[model samples]
Target: MDTQFFLSMDPPTVTYQEKRAGVRNGKPFFYEDGDLKAARQKLKAHLSKHRPKKPYRGGVRLVVKWCFPRGKHRDGEYRITKPDTDNLQKLLKDCMTAVGFWTDDALVASEIVEKFWAERPGIFVRIEEL
Candidate 1:
């Protein structure tokens, strides 16, 4: 099955790379930064409505277009700023997994991710079984 959806919100620039590490009782632990936590919650909340009834079990191709609010850049311009594409996808896929889009994000065998400046800020996602 194929699934596609658009989330209408400013795509958060915070990425999974924001996870912080600390030592507790001589043991190392990792935790999300406050901004990263907020970003994950926001993405999960938006992704919840589009969750599939059954998680995809086969390899899947995932496409994501992150559209940020247009500032000085023109609409549709490729965003070449902070937050690399891979980093952005990492956080998003984590949220997708948490929201049950798939049993595990490792099921994703292919990915195409892009970021852009846009008049209507939002995220566009397309998932196809492969």
Candidate 2:
């Protein structure tokens, strides 16, 4: 099965209090509220069960996604832009380095995309150039 590994780059900063003041202050995905590690595991389990229908080029293609109505805010089609031949090659190199797959010169700015995937903050999706 085609699969891609997506380890959150930054720390888990997703936080929101579901209860009112004095009720119970809380953090998002925290161990007390929920196990984020388990969430990742659950997500992986779900994916493994569904069996992706496309090929995984080490995260270099379209990842068809599904969203429930309540998650309208998270709806998006994301992908990193494909740079020119040399740039594309360099991007792949940097991406590997960023993900700890390689140890070459690393730079996040090297990845370029032709389309507007998303520009909002707190977003954790990137469409890789296929």
Off by over 4 Å in 2: 1-34, 52-59, 71-129
Model 2 C-alpha RMSD vs. true structure (Å) is: 13.1
lDDT of 1 by residue, 1-130 (tens): 8999999999998899988999999999999988999999999999999999899989999999999999999999999988899999999998999988998899999999989999999999999999
Q: If scored against the real structure, what TM-score would every candidate get?
A: 0.96, 0.25
Q: Please report, as a residue range, the 10-residue window in candidate 1 with the lowest summed lDDT.
A: 10-19
RMSD of each: 0.8, 13.1
lDDT per residue (tens digit) for residues 6-41 in model 2: 322221221222112333356443232454343334
- The residue pairs found clashing in candidate 2 are 78-127, 79-127, 80-127, 81-113
